[model samples]
Target: MKARTALLVLIVALLGYLAFFNFSTLAQDVPMSLGFTEVHGPLGLVMLALYALMAAIFLAYVIAMQATWLLEVRAHNKALQAQRELAEKAEISRFTELRGALDDKQTQWEKRVMERLDALENHLKARAEESDNVHAAYLGQLEEQLRNQPGKESPPALGQQ
Candidate 1:
């Protein structure tokens, strides 16, 4: 138990022990004033009974308040747990969406790269073919020029040699 509550219990126990041991003194009659009128009663016992009644009422109130607070705490905890779960789910969803987006971007990039490579390959092949044609044309012109020389014997044509 908490220190304060333990102390309160100890005090109540001592008071109860005192009251039990001095029952006769407590029961002795005495004069008392009711706010409205004067009366005679066992003054000590009456005071003790009133104190007990007040203690009982206060204790009941304390117990009820504590019970209400406990219930409120439980409800708040449940609400917090639910919110935490929702946040986790949302985070998971965002991650999944990001993953999908990345996958799509990678796929598009790969496709574009492949297309670019294919275009480049085609362009290179066309350039190589054009170069070969130009080389053949130059060879033909050289052979003709050599054959047409006026005073020099044309050496046997290039490939024939």
Candidate 2:
């Protein structure tokens, strides 16, 4: 059992014992006064009744405080759960934003790479065309020279007269 419960039981038992011990005296009639009137009652019993009334009020106050504390704790837990949910949503949004940004960057990088590759292909094609033109011109010039020197006899082979 809880310490508070134990202490409350002990106090109640002590009060009961005291009241029982004074029961004989409490049976004797005495005079009591209120502001508006006077009454006759057993003095010990009146005092015991008053003590019981005060104990009841004190117990009620304690119960009220405990109920208030429980309500506050419940409210606090609800607020904490809300905050956690909010944080989770925020984190998910952040991740989504980051993912979108990465995708955009990846797309841009791919576009740039494709454009560079196209430019390189065009440049290489142009270079190949220029090389072919130069080769064709050189062959044409050699054929013309051969036609002009036909009457002078073709040049001998390297090992022949």
Candidate 3:
């Protein structure tokens, strides 16, 4: 739509310029009214200047629109990048938290294992001491019985007379 409007404006300006420069030739066929006046020197120059001004204004508008589009695209990309960084940081923090919890569990398990091992060692040592004491008491009783027995006595043969 904008292209068609620009083309129409250009065609109108070209026809006006032709009519202004060759007024006598164009007027030969068409009847002129009292109100119609031919465009002359200063008026034609002013029209041309106005046409140039309109073209410049259109060009400036196009440039401004393009600049605004580029700026908006840059801003969108920056926002996307910031969101990605935030997600990555959140993932890293989650991993760290999980690792810390795992380490804590491992330490607790190790402590419980050491405590059980210490208790088993103490129980076995006590049992060994009890067995040694029982053996010593039995040996003392055997020696006392032997000493109380007689040292000499008459003995009978198989078929004693």
Best by TM-score: 1
Write the residue-wise lDDT of candidate 2 on 15-106 in tens digits: 88977887888879988898799999898887888888998899899999999999999999999999999999999999999999999999
Identify the runs in model 3 with alpha carbons over 4 angstroms from their true place.
1-37, 40-62, 134-161
TM-score of every candidate: 0.68, 0.66, 0.48
> Each candidate: what lDDT?
0.95, 0.88, 0.74
Residue-pair clashes, model 1: 0
Per-residue CA lDDT of candidate 3, range 18-106, in tens?
86887665444433333767533444445556776897898799899999999999999999999999999999999999999999999
**Candidate 2 TM-score over all chains jointly:** 0.66
Best by lDDT: 1
Rank ordering of all candidates by lDDT, starting from the highest: 1, 2, 3
* Model 2 Cα RMSD, 1 decimal: 5.5
